[model samples]
Target: MHDHAHGIRQGDNRRLLAVSLAITGVVLVVQVAGAILTGSLALLADAAHMLTDAAALVIALVASAVAARPADDRRTYGYQRAEVLGALVNAVVLIALSVGIVVEAVSRLLAPEPAPVAGGWMLAVAVVGLLANMLAAWLLRHAQKHSMNVRGAYLEVIGDMIGSAAVIVAAIVILLTGWTRVDAIASLLIAVFIVPRAIGLLREVFSVLSESAPAGTAVADIRTHLLRTPGVRDVHDVHVWQLTRGAPVFTAHVVVEQEVLERGSGALLTRMQGCLAEHFDVAHSTFQLEAAGHEEREHH
Candidate 1:
């Protein structure tokens, strides 16, 4: 039953990512042409950002598909970790793109005679790009909450939106005051917006890859909860981690009264599993019920 629901969600994620990728690809082509026609650094920077976003979306799409594969003999947990790896790649690409944009912006600012920028053309193109980004963001907003791969694509679209806005502002200022350096300044601002978000995403990807417990879940709290179960005397060797976003796995050795163990463990197991699912949002759990003093006998 859980597998059925998860498969549906994966299908939804892939559809959303595919639509967003199409939108971004169209915007990338438009922005590239706009930048060439307008000679605006802001537009060019936005185009470059979109280029990377399109690539990121492709990676996310592939990862989502791979993650949907069922577990096999060799790969017990399936390919869910593929999504995390995809997100990690997206973060690195974003950081590198931001650094490149910053370097170019600085060079443009230092130049004595800046390139001519056509304000009207830049404004028209930027507005179009902004509207496209908004559509893509709306599509991914809900899915991003549940999947790291979707979130990576969503963040890149958001950054593109900001870059478009910066380009529009630069165009307006150029039209009003004829200060072309604002175009370079706008590019710098876009780069600044990208780095922090990418770094934060990178941190989350690392946490998942390192097999750390899901955010906001404490192992100690899980141990305490398990110990409270009827017939459960103690809990040890408790382990909690995630296969992917929203997919937590838990395992623990539960010490129960000797009489309870001798009688049966079925009812106790159901109760403990229910407790974990209700309190900790952990649907996949394994508990080994043991007689008291069992831990003392086992070699570590």
Candidate 2:
């Protein structure tokens, strides 16, 4: 048996997340104050969403830092999965915030409350918030591709930006015509964007937690390739799962000829690991090279 991992590292995302965390924390305070002064549901919803963004960035920073630690005997796989856990939490929080905003918006729409909306003030605050969210989004854009933690933070800022835009539009309508219901309408629209992004994040986190195959990985192709390798007569118990985002692990049993096992077994193992690394981008793999009929013995 052998284990092969190409390259796995962490901590690189911490700096980006730290900057984002600071920006979100400051923006959250501003938005909250704006919501209070203007009593705009759209601004309030955007503030609430910003609060989650701050929390997500904080968790992402910590997770990235923890995952950077080297592997030890007590934890051979290291703390790489912490990032996925952080992402999972972020997704849940986003869903809750979205639901809360939607419910509040619906109530306001139906009840038609006399909201004290300061159009000019809310518009100014929202524009500032939008700029801040855009900056944070740009900082996290590149890292979000391979790291779920980064993606979670990126999505939050994007959602916040959308909410801010909706608030801006509402402010314009309120400024031009004395319509307060536009605020509630804008909040409802913001919720619409939030829910879909939250669902996507949830799906990605669940895939990792469930040990599902990583995106784009083809199990059948891998099996066929292994069978074609020299000295490999049979393949069974093959499995593939992601240890974390961008880190795939593979395990399988390969039946070999008796003579091949005795003379050049080590070489075959290297070839199998190499194929997985080069072709499939699989970093870690474990192969149990056995004599023919080993699969039958396992059943008993």
Stretches of candidate 1 above 4 Å error? Answer: 1-8
**Candidate 2 stretches greater than 4 Å from native:** 1-9
Clashing pairs in 2: 5-283
In candidate 2 the C-alpha lDDT for residue 237 amounts to 88
* Cand. 2 TM to true fold: 0.91
lDDT values, one for every candidate:
0.90, 0.88
Listed in order, each prediction's TM-score against the native is 0.95, 0.91
Candidate 1 at residue 238, lDDT? 85
Candidate 1: worst 10 consecutive residues by lDDT?
1-10
Model 1 per-residue lDDT tens digits across residues 42-80: 999999999989999999999999999998999988898
Q: What is the C-alpha RMSD of each candidate to the true structure, in Å?
A: 2.0, 2.1
